[model samples]
Target: MNTYYYYDDKFLLTLYAYLKQTESSIVRGLSDKWEPASIYLEKHSLTHKLIDTLNSNKINPNEKFDNIFYKAYLRVKGKQFITSNEADNIYILLKAINEAIYYKKPQIYILGFLRKEIIKTSNKIRTRISCKKRKLLADNVEHYNQHYNGKFYTIEQIVNGL
Candidate 1:
């Protein structure tokens, strides 16, 4: 936020509330189109080059994915929402962030206090959908997170593989 770079809106700050980055503003971004990779993200931070695909049927953080990913990786992952309720929640959060970043709105109240709360507990908003839909949305999100919209990599990890 030092330079305050943004998307079409204050998408950055709202994103900051979810993911984080280096303050100097030199960033390497990633897309949420991420599939079930290795269990590495749990043991270490998020700096993997290429990852193994998940054999299980969950999207959490373990051999089965952890739910924390849903909150922590929203920029790359937010589009996973299935219901209008979840979609609207994502829309509202993004719009509020836009207002906050551009119009000087309060981060805590508008964005909600805890980042976790914003996604699940605060408003208790859950965009849970069927796994079939989840996979489809994941494909679309990967496109946006990688090509169309993309995002600044808040949590950075150097790739040792490459």
Candidate 2:
């Protein structure tokens, strides 16, 4: 099956920095700076509203600022899947990355991260669906164990590679 992977703002920023060959210190600083903002956003109930506003036209005109806010917004919201708007934003970023003048690390690193996320999300959905189909029969138990156990093992390998 085709799976969709969501890249939150933080991951996108990190990927952007990585692609741009940004200094590790600056990347670390970005992560450190986001922590408190994330905490404050979580403590208050404004994460969703903030995300909505960031995606709105008023903010969208300034792509750089919009991306920054989007990263902060994702750091706060902490959801695994991207909304449709977020997906569109990410697509734009990916295109920008592709057209950049300089070549650094292969883009596969970002693709690898995307693959890992897709695997994680698919495993979660599989678990939920299997749980609903679970039955008392030994055959059902065997099927459940076999399917999910194998899936998790593959997920573990992918995560470790990531």
Candidate 3:
């Protein structure tokens, strides 16, 4: 089966940065960042109001744009909507999802600090991708007995082992 991993914007950017700094294993989709922005612009009345208010007030173009995005982001803040619209939060989420769904791999593997409660809440293709936190670990921690000082294994190690 072809697998697709969907994540919020921030995580994707971090994964992009990581790929830039190191290896080129991860390839991400364009869906993360602007998807929400498009939705905000097209559907959300609040976003429309923000844009209208900004344009009507003749706010500086850059500041007006920023405020519109900020308000749109705030509209989904603190909820499961990427934790926070901060670059870090979006980056982390996208990175994890990108890693999980890297390429069009037949069997997708999601790895990250995914929380259990959130998994239970999912009920779709997304649910398939999300884990019950680390239920895999709980189910078979023995398989992952070795730890690299509580850190991610280096790319070299993964390459060598594979």
Best prediction by lDDT: 2
Least accurate stretch of 10 residues (summed lDDT) in model 3?
20-29
In model 3, the clashing pairs are: 10-90, 10-91, 11-90, 11-91, 11-92, 11-94, 11-95, 12-94
Q: Per-residue lDDT for 74-122 in model 1, tens only?
A: 3354422223353344445444433333332233343333234333422
lDDT of 2 by residue, 73-119 (tens): 54465433344544455445444333221233335445345334433
Better of 1 and 2 by TM-score: 1
Worst 10 residues of 2 by lDDT: 135-144
Tell me the deviation in Å of residue 124 in model 2. Answer: 21
lDDT, each prediction? 0.26, 0.32, 0.28
Candidate 1 regions exceeding 4 Å error are 1-81, 105-108, 111-117, 121-162
Cα lDDT for residue 97, model 1?
Answer: 31
**Comparison by lDDT, 1 against 2, better one:** 2
**Which scores greater on TM-score, model 2 or model 3?**
2
Task: Rank the models by lDDT, top first.
Answer: 2, 3, 1
Number of the predicted model whose TM-score against the real structure is largest:
1
Q: Model 3, range 1-162, lDDT digits (tens) per residue? A: 321122322222222222221111221112233233223222211223322432333332333324546545544442112222332333343344343332333222232132221132222212222233322222211111223364343323322331
Q: Give the local distance difference test score of model 2.
A: 0.32
